[model samples]
Target: MTRHLPSRRQALLAGLALAAAGCAPLPRAGTASASSRQLPQERVRAAAPFPMPDISVPDFSASRRFPITDFGAAQGDQQKTSAAIAQAIAAAHAAGSGVVVVPEGVWPTAKIHLKSNVNLHVAKGATLLFSERPDDYLPAVMTTWEGLECYNYSPLVYAYGCDNVAITGEGTLKAKLDVWKVWYARPKPHMDALVALYHLAAKRVPVEQRQMAVGQANLRPQFVQFNRCRNVLVEDVSIVDSPFWVLHPYLSRDVVIRRVKVRAHGHNNDGVDPEMSQNVLVEDCVFDQGDDAISVKSGRDQDAWRLNVPSRNIIMRNCRVKNGHQLMAIGSELSGGVENVFVDNCHFDNAGSGARSTINNILFVKTNERRGGYVKNIHVSNVSATRIAGGVLSVETDVLYQWRDLVPTYERRLTPIEGLHVSNVKVDEAAFVCRIQGEAEMPVKDVSLRGVTVAKVLEAPVSTVNVQGFVHAA
Candidate 1:
């Protein structure tokens, strides 16, 4: 189901609300104090538009179908259906290239790992329900969590080292939330395991030696992940209640996620995380997420420096976000680098619920001193938002979370960010139009904002520190 954009009347109401709250617009380009010499009028510059990526989904014209029902699998029987589905996938893989059909029913299952040239298709009116038992995902697979590599629980649907893989159908992929909800609390054991994993990753231990599924690690796996795969496509699926990140494509290339709907308002349930992957496109999607709607990430710390693969040529367009922290976020784990990202013609709905009842920001770039990566060539344009509780744009360099106090900064590496452009954007209400805090030594540079309008802002419209060549012009 496609989400509808807010009407002009709604936008007007939002503007009126901000005005009633006594919010005012900031001064335009030339009206800053002498002490704020860094934010000069000449600093604002026009940005050249980035070219749209040329990407397409793979053609499966010659593929045959391998239906699960033909292999003795019935609905509601978790164990039997899970095995039967696996068998169907194997059969399709063995047959060169084929589609594995999941018929119309609520098929409860365990973990499902895809092979090359396999398309897992769930038919209309069907739900691929995952099991609530933790043991179902035992014998951990090689996966990354927050940026470190370790052997953790297998994702609900995983594809590793595959080619021409797709999960395309008009059906739902849901998680049995009873177990995952408990794991979200991050108890003592979970924190301890996280710290232990950080030490192992920082020390540059072999990935195979960093086992993490045992003990109380309880590291929640992603709902679906394509790891080190190429030519991947995920479309027309309604995902609900993810255990972790909803859709993750790590170290993959030529990936496309389009015409999808994700509603996973659980902890760490980012709608889509394109990590260390290149040539990616996410378009025509709807997201109601617990975290950032779309987060561009690379590797972390030593692990990232070893791989040295940056996430580039990523694009998100024609999307709508009902609830999210940031419509688009970069980093906190971007050690390898994130560049050449383009977001266009998207809408963010500030009408959220519970703790996120107020939308945080439309775009946020967060990194810390410990994360040594670069973020560049980010272009966002033609965006609209009804309301935002926080700043419309924020570039923070000292956003250290739990790791700030938990673990000491073993290596003091700082990121260099530049070439950010936001143009032709509109918002009805916001706390601030821009809030940027760059490092003293490594200041952010070359940020340009043009043709942007915020009807009302409660706080200062533009706030900056140690930034140069930042232009704010209508």
Candidate 2:
């Protein structure tokens, strides 16, 4: 007997009620709770266009401090500092809860791995200059490259299966890109390696065996990744020049990334990538990136569907973009699904001058037939931009960058996109106001635009292919 599956509408409705079903009143920040010995919860209450729960984040203000200097970390010494950071982190975790402090100095390090209940705090006037050698990130860890899971080179700062971890302070975390700059080129060898990884993921090979850190793979590691961790926080840190994505929260939950500044213009250097994560809040951050400022993603096609964890209840507000392809981009790697995202009160400050400007759409939702997931209830409001290279809103259903020809479809399933709303957005100039290139079978639905004023439109005001229930107002 053939079993019946829920229709797209049913799935979307179920997702809409997910937050309300699992939501509970969280304790305010700094309050003691039953899990106080673990990570104390802090309530994050923000007004969203859809139903959302108050996100819980880690609070480490009153924790004990373990200064790296006390652990024999010396300025300008890479090996000693790296060992010292590890020691300090171990000490903090052993103490149940503590902050691993990096004192005020320019210290070179290899990789800093965070543990549970440990906040790696870089103090004022401190800069952690990461090493450029590839060997420093050896011994492949569980990480994802472009949404596909693998045991690749460890990220510069990685946390795996840890609860209540953070990286906070008024200092800079910079990457020395001497080697990573050359690895950015996608030559024939790199393309072949990506194809191999794709086939492995499609075949459901064990993540342990799908290593891409070998010779000529050139898969750049993210600067910071909180992998499968809970109650994560990264606040008030300045990041300069990353190998890849600046800040990544992958398969994690209850994350808060606030007041961070990222200036990474290297290839594929997205500012923040919240991939397959839930209940995340990114606020009051500044991004000058080489790719999208905020790219929300789930996993890739077969691997993502196997994981079956959709990114849900994400909110990004009061953020500023200096240069990026989009203010917020969803998908092109989303197969697990994405829903109930809210982007509010963001500004794209003159996105660099002249030819350097790269601002694109305010909100771009992109997927293809292989994605096989659903996107719904995405809302963007109160956004202001100087000049948009693309448009205000763009929903494309046939966006498979190099995979269009690089790899064949292992499973063919079209994405179901609906309930996209944008309001109170003003841009000085744009190619269009709205562009929708939806498939005929699954036309984009319920797209509403209100008070979207494009001062200058270089092309048609609205361009659409297959869209339903499209409402536009002045």
Q: How high is each candidate's TM-score?
A: 0.88, 0.92
Q: What lDDT score is found at residue 173 in candidate 2?
A: 98
lDDT string for model 1 (380-452, tens) is 9999998888876899999988888988888899999999899999999899999999999999999988998
Error of 2 at 347 (Å): 0.4
lDDT of 2 at 172: 95
**Candidate with best TM-score:** 2
Error of 1 at 104 (Å): 0.9
For candidate 2, write residues 294-413 as lDDT tens digits: 999999988888778889999999999999899999998899889999999999975452237888899999999999889999999999998889999999999988888999998899
Off by over 4 Å in 1: 1-48, 51-53, 350-356
